[model samples]
Target: MSVSSQHEGLCLRYPEPLGPQANVSYEAAVSMLMRAIQLAQHTPFVWGYIDKPQEGHIYLIFMTQQLPFPPDGIRYQDQEQKIIMPAGPGRELEVMEVKFGFVPNSSDTTAWRVRRRYRMHKGGHPQLVLIHYGRGQPMPIMPNLNQPVRNYPLRPINEPALFVMGEKIGQKVYPNQHSGPAERPGPPGMGMSFGGIGNQQAMLAQQNNNLEALERRSQRDRSGSMNARAPPPARIEDDDSADESDMMSTRTLALTRYKRNHELMNEVFMYAAFSRKKEFPPPKSPYSVFDIANVEARVAKMTAEIDELRSKAEARREARSNADGAVGDDPGDVSMEVSGTTEEVPT
Candidate 1:
């Protein structure tokens, strides 16, 4: 595999197997593996793995360096293996399981039985487990391996750095050593030096004197400005009183305007309701003689006149009804007397 510049000269060891007893979730295991890969980008070597040593559990072992086995005893046979690469950004890791008919001669039949049981558990489907290598490649078959193992170029997983103590995750921590004590910061307006304490003291005293002189000048300037800007007590009181009177006058004028507008609106409504023609007059200007108190007194007088008119109309209707009843009763009496006179004439 062609190594990138960042991974050049760095050899990664075989990743150690992780089992169920480790109490690590699948996501946490993947995170740990990715973190190790990130560290390997800057360091010489890193080791990581993802596997559970149980039936139906898949194995993903990562290694950059050559295997440490004897070349003659281990034969590398080519087998069909699928490679899963991230399609785009923000894609999760995907795993593919394939069936491997070729089993190693070194392993006992118990391993093959477990494999069969796992396949049976999966409903007799082919067991094909593919690792997330950068590119597609064939897996190397070896003796004494019950499962298929693949090797491909290493690519860093896109993820945030893991939280690890005493180490800067995703960054290199270089050892910075000093041959002597750290240089302390010198006083203001002074250069740092290792020698000549007497010279430093003299420079410090001079700086203090300059600062004191500047402070005294600033104080004198502030006092002079204050005295020049301050107004006389009597003048200040007069200005305050004038501002208060102006505010009061403005408030009173605004209130009078509001009351006049309100009265005008009330007059318009009353005229619209009670006028003979039911027509509203044109609006007048604000400066027109429209007194709120005069409008209120007129409204009261109109209300009293309406009440008196209603009472008089009711009394006249009552008196007309009584006069009509009296006239009808007299006609009935006259008809009775005429009938009596006719009866006496017949006798």
Candidate 2:
């Protein structure tokens, strides 16, 4: 069973397909992985992950080294160690079991944990297996290589992994939230580090400085303040990854402008057909109301023009024949035809 949340206007009518080279948002990818872990340990049914051997190894190392503590059942299979979270109340214990995709199925968790512990004490790579279940119960199963989930959002190694999962991941499975001056121990050996949401926001702000530079160029263009060739967009030194991200960002802005222009055109046409004065809609209506008071002046002018036209028609009718008088209730009536002359409708 699946549950979903949707926002109407924000929903894309036709979402573009993500190319193989596209970069997934770091937070989104990590959040999904956290969900998978949560499912593996918390749910009675088997839940698992299947990834490249190298990625699997990196993930194991990162979690054990960097993370504060494993949620109830999270057991790192390779290293022989038991990780526990900081003391707290209102906490639920989980039973987690994880299996590497390429690892052998016959591996024993307790024995493997002992070995991992021995090797870590000796300082080396350990054959790790996480067990958060009873001996009689089955371990979580990893998807087969051929059965690897497709279309799941995941970040490519080349992409900048700029996200902070904090003391816990998302609003699920464990440390729901955290705030303090406690200097958390981060992952060692690996070039990775952990920072709270504040650090991630700083990184994002630094990145957007490039975008702000682009905005200044645009402002120059719109104002014609400087007569010069527009500056080319600034590209990050790292090859096409930054370019790809910037392209995705720009496409959204362009599409937004396109929609806004179309909406404005429609509103203008609606007002043209029926004067705003005739149908003064709500202030917040989509129709234009910039020159609302002026519209009344324009309407009065139009009425005067129509009155002048009626006077001219009366004079022509009187000149044609004094006895040429007729009353017709039907708007379609065409009596008293005058040749070589256009007839004005009775106002």
lDDT of 1: 0.34
How do all models score by TM-score? 0.24, 0.18
Candidate 1: residue 150 Cα off by (Å): 4.6
All models: lDDT?
Answer: 0.34, 0.30
Among all candidates shown, the one with the greatest lDDT: 1
In model 2, the worst 10-residue window by lDDT is: 7-16
Over 1-347, each residue of candidate 1 has an lDDT whose tens digit, in order, gives: 23341233222222222121212223332333343343222222132323222332323222212322111111223333433334234433433323323334434232221111111112111111213211112343434564433323434432222112112212212224110111122244321111222454453454345434433443454466457675423322122243223222343335445876889899999888777765678998885788888999999999999999999999999999999989877633222346447433332
TM-score of model 1 (CA atoms): 0.24
The sequence of per-residue lDDT tens digits that candidate 2 reaches over residues 133-185 is 21222334433322322333432222112111221111121222121101122
Can you give the lDDT of residue 168 in candidate 1? Answer: 22
The candidate scoring highest on TM-score is: 1
